[model samples]
Target: MQKLTIQWQRLLNDKNQTCPRCSETGETVNTGVLKLKNALAELGIEVELIQKAIDFSVFENNPLQSNSILINGKLLEDWIGGETGKSKCCDVCGDSECRTISFGENTFESIPENLIIKAGLLAAAELIEN
Candidate 1:
């Protein structure tokens, strides 16, 4: 089997508060990855998987929902099944109240579990399919 690489963009940068929602999203992706790893392991599938995370702020020019799923560098937007809302305050910031974190339109606060799972599975299968 080949190695699969999963990459995700995070909305919460180093400057902002630790967004639980974003963390939850990361956990969801990791869980799916774990599932794939274990299942493949049982089959003696020699597959190597690596998850990559990037800050959304890097794409300063484009802010048109880059938080998408990718299968071998190809954006699988359909698999990124998360509903994106307009710009909003940082609900996960501060100790007791929500704070305003200025992130451009491209930032993704959270990704739905379904998208993550689908992406994970796709990447997993891509290892064997490719």
Candidate 2:
């Protein structure tokens, strides 16, 4: 059986609250990915979405992308980024020299459901992209 993989590495920025943009993006990805999972199950295709909100410091040594969506271990920019792609200030990780993780691809706040759905379909592995 073949399994599709969807990974969203949300790098935490501020201590008080997760970045609004990232928060929304994460929620969209989670919900969309879950739906994709159930849909693919009928085809006997497994889906794995790594649900971990990692810190910026970890991204420094992260094998995968920090603020990006990866499908089947491939870094493909199909989802949304933060307001600014630059690192933001964080009091909690101040001494740690860690800042908010940004990808700089979006000027908006939310990741569209359609985008994640597209990503999910692409991650199916068996889908033929023409």
Candidate 3:
């Protein structure tokens, strides 16, 4: 299969999509493609799969709602703080887990994509058939 490269901006413009985390946007960065790509590439599966598989949620304006990535209808939690686990605080409480000796190290957070891979294929296949 040809590698799929989805420009972040282009994909986020789709009217049918919404950011599951913050609900403000469903942009590409929400999928953690850039960060997860390195880890995923090790598995031999194209990072494009992240774009292919996205899951959307209802649009609601709530401050409590996280604007992070969603994986399989779940918020992509981060143990490490910041973008891609660099200088990140605790995913929980957003605390400085790194600096405080009492606080443990940060961990990996998993965010959900706007579309799930299976759902993406279904949508793609439907488009093709039509």
Candidate 4:
């Protein structure tokens, strides 16, 4: 069977809590991954999700890196032809701005599951083509 991997990274505070945006995105990602697994199973494509926690030191340097999603090693935005932006995040993220995704007129601080599913389908298409 072929494989498609979805990776998500988010900043975690000392208390191991992520910002509200990241927390919500994580839930969306989980749902997206499950949906992809079921949708792609018949196509012989296996969906895998890898969630990573970024250390405070790392997030401090590049907060934009937090709450990032990658599908099959490519940025989720890249796959969906979206843009990456940053906005002020909550207390768990300190003063650093967190990652956001812009899809045309819509800008999301917490990524929507539809976007994830769309990206996963695109990735799955590429996997089949290759």
Off by over 4 Å in 1: 16-20, 42-60, 63-69, 79-109
lDDT tens digits by residue: candidate 1, 3-108: 5555654444566434565566567666766776676676545434344443435423333333434555655444344333434434433222221112234434
lDDT of 3 at 49: 30
lDDT of 1 at 40: 67
Ranking by TM-score: 4, 2, 1, 3
Candidate 4 weakest ten by summed lDDT: 89-98
Task: List model 2 lDDT by residue over 1-130, tens digit each.
Answer: 6777777766664463455555677888888888988888897788887866776567456423434667777554433323223444244334332223233444333455566776577667445331
Best-matching candidate per lDDT: 4
Point out where model 2 deviates above 4 Å.
13-16, 58-66, 78-109, 125-130
Best by TM-score: 4
Better of 1 and 3 by TM-score: 1
Of the candidates numbered 1 and 2, which has the greater lDDT value? 2
**Tens-digit per-residue lDDT, 1-130, candidate 3:** 2232332211121344433332323433544455445544554434453333222221122112333333333323322222333223333223321111111343323223433232333333333354
Candidate 2 vs candidate 3, TM-score winner: 2
Q: Score each candidate by Cα lDDT.
A: 0.49, 0.58, 0.31, 0.92
Candidate 3, residue 7: CA error in Å? 14
TM-score of 4: 0.98
Ranking by lDDT: 4, 2, 1, 3
